[model samples]
Target: MATLSYAAKDSRTMVRRNLKKALRYPSLTLTVVIMPIMMLLLFNYAFGTALGSGIGPSAAGGGEYIDYLAPGIILMAATSGALTTAISVCVDKTEGIVDRFRTMPISRASFLTGHVVGSVIQTMTSITLVIAVALLVGFRPDATPVEWLAAIGLLALLTLALTWLSAGIGLVAKNVETASNIPMPLTFLPFIGSAIVPPESMPAGLRWFAEYQPFTPIIETLRGLWLGTGIGSSAAIGLAWCVALTVVGYLWARRTFKAGAKR
Candidate 1:
């Protein structure tokens, strides 16, 4: 009972703290909200039409190009949030906020939990906005209610995994600027994979990379869920990646935090 109470209390406190920070920085919230939508609109209406004709809508999965692209955009939005979370954590560490927290009697997990929860909430809002814009531009998900829920569950898992990875970067980043730079590769990774366009259209070398990369599996799983398509090995791969990354990142972050505490 005490454990349960501690868990509940920690969750509540963390969420409240994060929300207050978000409210204080309205511009950050706006940036997080608008950037994803802009990327969606720019890619879909502008570039998608040109690429759609060549890929042939059917070859690209028989759906509208925007629909095909929506999953990637959602993932991109989540990635952005994760990157922001890492940078925020790094900043807090440098600003002595983390040190202050370390002095408290609260659970160490509470500090990380609050930031991850806050980031997930922020990412979800960004995703909703992107989806709304995608709808306006004729993107639609054909999945049933259950499938939709599962898709959302996968996204949440993906977000949590990435947030943990980012937290590790935050714990070790030499400075705030360097911390933000760490997630750049991940931010650009989806674009290189089959997220925006099918891998078949790319050069053979690029195709190989796109087909084999972690982003492909994630994008594929999301696409299948959104479009009500048959599940493939990609979903399994995505789940594996999420599990592996989360475990490794959690262990590393904990170790780094412990070392930092001694310093």
Candidate 2:
């Protein structure tokens, strides 16, 4: 009982440390917030007319398209923000910070816990900013208060999964550049998924991959919650994926960290 309490307390301390570092630096967090907003603007203004036409006549221009695009762009914000976790973790590993921590009596779990929790908080903040910009640009969700809560909860789960995966990547990466680059695919996976266009619009091979990829179901689930589209099996599948990713990431990160500590 006491051990669990102490671990929790230590994790909170680490979370605060990471959050303070983010506030002091701010550049990475700013990039996380800005990229999604820029993408939202570009797609809504430059291509909204052309692309929205395909979705529906009403969707043409920035009108209905923003509604469709906002969820995906918001998810992208989460993905982009998750990258910071890997970079920060790699920085700590490279700078001998972890080695220093090893000498302390703190809980080993707290280090990774801190990074993942802190990244999730930052990612969600970025998502909130993206959603705000989306609303400003005419992205209207048809969700009730309950649906809004569910959607936010789902987004938080997705962010948690991605942050854990990023933590594992950070532990394994040989350098900060590699750590940063490894998670790049995650940010753009939505482009290939139902995030931007229906998989039915793609060629057979590409569409197959797009539909099966983890992000597609997630985006579909979010779209359903926010826009009242058919969720079908996406909510269940997305939840499964989040759980699976969290388990995989947590195990991998713990194993890698343990291996390093032994050395």
**Would you estimate the TM-scores of all the predictions?**
0.93, 0.97
* Clash totals for all candidate models: 0, 0
- Kindly list the per-residue Cα lDDT of model 2 for residues 152-193, writing each as its tens digit: 998899899899899999989999999999999999988998
C-alpha lDDT values of all predictions: 0.81, 0.89
Candidate 1 per-residue lDDT over residues 1-263, each given as its tens digit? 99768876987798788878888986766776677778888988789888777667663357878878888888887777777788878988999999998888777778777887887887787777777787888887878898888888888888888888888899889898999899888877888987688898899999999998877888888888888655579899999988888898778777888789899
Candidate 2 ranges with C-alpha deviation above 4 Å: 57-63
Candidate 1 local lDDT, residue 198: 86
Who wins the lDDT comparison? 2
Scored by TM-score, the top model is 2
What TM-score does model 1 achieve against the real structure? 0.93
Model 1's alpha-carbon lDDT is 0.81
